[model samples]
Target: MSRSGGEKERKYESDESRIDSGIDSYKSISRDPYWSLQSSEEKDKSSCGTEERLDSAYASSSLTVDSLGDFIEKCSISEGENATDSENNNEEEVNLLTTVTEDGDTILHLAIIHEEQHFAHQLIELFPRELLDIQNNLYQTPLHLATYLNQHSIVKDLVANGVSLELQDQDGNTPLHVACERGFWDCANEMIHNASPNKLAHVLEAQNWRGLTCLHVATVHKQRRLMRLLMKKGVNLNTQEGTSGKTALHMAVELHDVYMVNLLLNSGTDVDAAMFNGCTALHLAVGRQDAAVANRLCQAGADKMIRNMEDETALDLADGNDDILALFPFDDIQIMGRTVINF
Candidate 1:
């Protein structure tokens, strides 16, 4: 063979030998528990299998406690081995805390979802503080999950540990918003009590993606207790939503929720508050043909002559409803400085 050909053959053999050596090294590392623990990809793959086993284990009623115990033990052993090495231990615990199911739920997330308070507490204690706020694929922290699930104990634990109360989920909903929306009064109250004064104010006023504050959410959901709680916390009753530019009073008027309207009005909500389109709460109440609500608005000092973008007053919108028109006598319904046109 030519010298060049022999050189090429030697190089080819050398490349093959290097490839084989690399494969053998990978195999050895894969077999080593410490090395495997350090491999995120391997841990992820194992997490998938572990979740499957968990699901199967949970399916059989008899295996529930035993399976959880076994799983917890396995996780504990992995965590215990690295305890002496604080940095590595933290990293490992973070990885474990954030190890997700197919839906990107950590074990902590699952524990909350399943209402396993003990397991959730254990995970909370084991995970690092920063990891407590680690978001799942949906950007939901453990606090969000616990609040959504109405897990009071878990919520309390998370709050006591200083998990972020104002962290927004994917939809820009804070845990407080979730609690109000879900009608979890206890959870909502817990959040309110546990939050720092500054954070409490921020959370109460914070708008979700739809631009609804906790007050708006309470009003929309007709959660009277939640609304009262927010009010006690000094939530702005007239805070307008981004989408409709309507305050909680506007929503209450539109929904014909007389009690909520009164609640808002008595709490100092702007009775004459207008939307982006310049439609006031009175205009909406009249449009909805809610005579009681209209009466309440008028009593609250809602302006009768306020014109919308269309230059229409509440009376103009109420022209078709005799009951509403009757609320305002002919003299009171007339626009100032204009000839009275009887409806």
Candidate 2:
């Protein structure tokens, strides 16, 4: 009888352990539906229709326009509540904004993406200004998207609504950086002009993750008009990027973009500005065998005698390249002496 009782007790303990394990597994699957899938076949079917699932989920009346309007109204009403109520209301408001699609795009993001300008405008007016800077899965705010998509009106609305101009995306590119990179002068102008005097300097000077200033971006893209506008705004013309230590003028010369080089030079850019490697614009021009650019640089008073870190002068870099060598007028001193005498 003792042996039989002991065996029965062991059996009961084993059965209870199995029951507990089953319950824990059920709870895990319940919390995450993805874990409930039995095979790769089920996972593929679920993953393939994610967008469609999101669309249907959004269409299920829980995330409709009416719901958004209701949410806005509720938040507005909660603003006048007592401290305790206000705290709870703020939490609720956060939850409303946190509601997102599978891609982590808020309703505002969708409105901007779909060009629902009227709806976007309504949402902008009703939503808290803080929501304007909320980033999507791409870490792009509505303002960033507007600037990138060239949505002028949306950009204006965002600015007018007091969105943070300094908000950076995943790559640390502020909206203004994107504007400068893409040569969106209109958008850039809007942002600059709309900014408070106190903020204007900060906005213009904000660098991207690559340590490129707005002026650096303009130079890299050969944006003559944008460059002029930025210069007019009194941006530091000689600001060198940390990576290459090359000023905009150096970049202009390197690209062999004579037009940009002329613009920079005429604007009083340091003609002989050198990179971190001590390579001057004249050195780069000679290396490219660009006679016209070389001549322009010489006329603008670029020091051809300047040596790079490699200990090579522009003429030395020219080596046997006659086109570049010929641009350096050997009679420069004679011409200067004659002019002075004539004067």
What is the Cα root-mean-square deviation between model 1 and the actual structure? Answer: 13.2
Work out candidate 2's RMSD over C-alphas.
13.5
Q: Which stretches of candidate 1 lie over 4 Å from their true place?
A: 1-69, 77-98, 332-343
Residue 46, candidate 1: alpha-carbon lDDT: 44
Look at candidate 2 and tell me the lDDT of residue 289: 84
Over 1-343, each residue of candidate 2 has an lDDT whose tens digit, in order, gives: 0124654454344434231121123223333544333342343334342322212211111233444557556554422468877677777767765677644567776566545576677778777888878876557788887787688788998999999888787677888888888889888888878888767778777777787888888889888888998888778878888787888888887888989988888888888788899998888888888888899999988886777888777887776787787866564442311322321
> Which candidate achieves the best TM-score against the true structure?
1
Task: Give each model's clash number.
Answer: 0, 0
lDDT of 1 by residue, 1-343 (tens): 0124554454344434231121123234334656434433333234342212212111111222334455555455343465456554566645555555544556776566556687789888877788788776567788987887688888888898889988898789999999998899989988888889998888888899999999899888999999999889888777889997999988888788899988888888888888999999998988888899999888888898888898888888885788898777575335532446755
> Candidate 2: minimum summed lDDT over ten consecutive residues — where?
52-61
The true-versus-predicted C-alpha distance at residue 79 of model 1, in Å, is 14
Residue ranges of candidate 2 with Cα displaced over 4 Å = 1-98, 329-343
